[model samples]
Target chain A: MQLSPSLSALVEALRCLPGIGPKSAQRIAFHLLERDRSGGTQLGQSLLNAMDKIGHCESCRTFSETPVCDICSNIKRQDTGLLCVVESPSDVLAIEQTGQYQGLYFVLMGHLSPLDGIGPNEIGMDVLERTLANGNINEVILATNPTVEGEATAHFIGEMCHQHNVTASRIAHGMPVGGELELVDGMTLMHAFSGRKAI
Target chain B: MQLSPSLSALVEALRCLPGIGPKSAQRIAFHLLERDRSGGTQLGQSLLNAMDKIGHCESCRTFSETPVCDICSNIKRQDTGLLCVVESPSDVLAIEQTGQYQGLYFVLMGHLSPLDGIGPNEIGMDVLERTLANGNINEVILATNPTVEGEATAHFIGEMCHQHNVTASRIAHGMPVGGELELVDGMTLMHAFSGRKAI
Candidate 1:
C-alpha cells in the first residue's frame, strides 16, 4: 500500500475536511481518479476559487466575495429591522429552508467553549456589539445552538445587548417536528412542557 | 438564511467530493472558518497545487506527477517477472497491503462496461499488451474484482495474454478468513469447495 507522496498528499488534503476519515478519503480519491476525472478536476478548481475569492462579510461574518455579504447589501432586507444570529452559514440555509424568518442575520462563526480555548472575541462578539450599537435593529435573536457552550454564549450576548438597550431573546427550544413522545430525550421533553402556552 | 453567490458556490464545490452530501459540505466549509483558518488556507492551496501538478501515469494509469509512476521506476520491482493485472490502481494498493506480492502491475483503471462505452482501448488494454509483449514477464495474474464486469474483463485479458503466449491465470476465489459458513453466499461456498486442495 505504498502510495506516492503526491497521492498521499491529496488524500491527506481531503482528510482535512470534517468527517472524512482515512479509509473514506482513500476510497474517494480512488473513485475520483477512476470514475469522474472532470468532477475531480472541478472540485480542485472550485476549492482554489473559493479560497481565493471568498472572505468574511464585515457585517454578518458570512462568506462573501465583497466586503459586505449579499444580505447586508440588499436594500429590501435592510428594512427588516430584525436580525437573527446563527453559528454558521449552513444553519442560515437550514432555517431559510423552512421559508420563515424574513429578517437579516449575524453569523457567530463559532460557539464559545473556554475549555477548547474558544472565547467571545474569537467568535466576533465585538462586531455583534458594534452592529447592535448602530441602533437600527429593533430586536436581537440569540439563536446560538442549545449546547452548553452555545447557551453560555447566548447568555453572554444577551447581557451585552442589554448594555446597548436592545431587547434580546433566545430562540425556542423543544421537541423536533415528527418526534415521538416515548423517544424524546428528557431535556427536550422538559423544554417542551415548560415552554407550552395556552392556545 | 440567504447565502451569497460565493458562499453558495463554495458549498456546491465541496459537495463534488465523494460521500460529501450537502449538509456535510456546509459543515466542512463553516468548520474551516471557525476552527482552523490556517488548515483551510492550506487545503485550498493544496487543491490548486495537486491540480496543477498531478496527472495519470502513462505506464500504470495511476495518478502521478511524472510520465511513469514511481513503482514502475523501481529497478528491484521490475525484475520480479510476475505481473498483476487489476481493474484500478486502488486494487494494486489493496494487494500490496497484503505484503506478499513482489511483482509489477498493469492497471485497467476500469472494467469493460460496453453499456457505459468503456471498452478495451478505453481502459488501456493496448498499454497492457505492449508491456506484456516485451517478453520480460512470465506470469500475468488477473487480479480484477469478483463483480460481473470484473469477471468479464479478467476473462478478456486472459484471452489476450494467451494470444501473446504469456502464462495467464485468475486470482483465487474463496471464502474470506473469519467468515462464517452460514453467512457465506452459495457461489462463494461452491468456489471454495471446488478449489479445495488435498491435505
Candidate 2:
C-alpha cells in the first residue's frame, strides 16, 4: 500500500530508529499526522537540535555537547583512578543509573565485528590505549556485555591493561540477584561456581 | 542521572510518540546520536516537511495537500451516492487498502466522547449533516469501530441520515475470517450467529 509522498517520507525516515520496522514506522507516521502535529514538530526540532549540538567527549568518547562529558570532567567522583570500559553511551547511562559505580568510563561505541570489518581501530581502541598510557588510571574494569564480540573486546582490553601495568578486572559473571538457580543458564551457573569467593 | 541538555530534550520530545515510554525514548535517542546521525537529521527534516505541507481536505476532512481529497475529487468511483462515514484519516487509509470500498468518505477525526467534551460538533458531524442534506447521497455506510464511543457516533449519524431521507447501513460485526470458533469471543460469536445470511 502506498501512502502520500510526505507520509511515505516520514515513515521511511522513522524506520531509521532502532527496533522500528516498516509497520511501526507507518503507525507512528499516521499517528503524528492524524493527532499530534505539534508534538511531531517538537520531535523534529529536538532531533535537529541534538544532532547539531551533541558530539563525542574527547576524554571518554561518550556523547556530550561540550569537549568533555559531564562524568569525565567532574572531579568529585571519588575514584578517578578506576576506569570502566563499556561498549556504548547507553551502557554508561545504564551504569550511572545503578548509582553504584563512582569510577570514570571509556566508551568503545561498538564491539569488534570481524565479518563487518570493524576492528580495534574502528572502535577507537587506539584512543583507549593512549588514555591507559597516561599512567593516572590504576585499575581498569571490563564491563562489556557477555556476548562473544563483547567478550573478545574485553579480553583484548585486559591484555592492553596488563602491558600498561594497570590492574585489570572483569565484572563478575554469575546468576543475577533474586534469580532462581533453575532459571540460570548453564554457563552462568558454572562461572558462578568457579568464581565463588571465600566467606 | 541527567543526560546532556540536547539529548534530554530529544528524549523528552520522543516520548510524545504513542506507545513510547521514558526508557524507549532514551534508547531511541542514544541510538540516533551514536550510529544514525544522518538518518536522524533526515527524520527531523521529514517531520517538518510533512507538518508544513499536509492539511485536512476541505470536503471529507481526510489528510491532503490540496483543498479536496483525492477520493472526493476522483470522478471514476462506481457509486458517488454511497458515502462511508469513518472515525479518522487512518480509517480511510485502511478502507482504501482493502480495494473493495470505491465510495468517498467522511472522516470524523474522533468518536463521540461526552466525558472528554467531544460531541457531534467537535467531530464535524454538522458538516456531515449539511452534506447529506445536499440530496446527492443515497446511502450512508456507518464504518465506525465497535467501541462504545464509535457505536454512539454511528447511531447519531444514522439518525441524521434518517432525518435527511437517506438510507443508512452498518458494517457487519462478527467473527473474523479464518478465525477459530473456540478462540472467538462470546459476543462476537453471538453477533455472527444473529447476523448470518442465506447463501
TM-scores for all candidates?
A: 0.90, 0.93
Instruction: Determine which window of 10 residues in candidate 2 chain A has minimal summed lDDT.
Output: A71-80
| Candidate 1 positional error at B76, Å | 3.3
What is the per-residue lDDT of model 2 for residues B143-185, given as tens digits with 9 covering 90 to 100?
Answer: 9998889989999999999999999999999989999999999
Residue-by-residue lDDT tens digits, candidate 1, A1-199: 5676666777787777777789888887777666666676666666666667778889999777899877788777778888888988777778779978778889887798888888989899889888998998888888989998889988998998899998889999998999899999899899999999899
Off by over 4 Å in 1: none
By lDDT, who's the top model here? 2
Q: For candidate 2, give the lDDT of residue A23.
A: 85
Q: Local error of candidate 2 at B122, Å?
A: 0.9
Provide interface RMSD per model, one decimal. Answer: 2.4, 1.4
* lDDT for model 2: 0.90
B104-180: candidate 1 lDDT, tens digit per residue: 88888789999999999999998888888899889999998999999999999999989989999998898999999
What is the fnat of model 1 with respect to the true interface contacts? 0.59
Best of the candidates, TM-score: 2
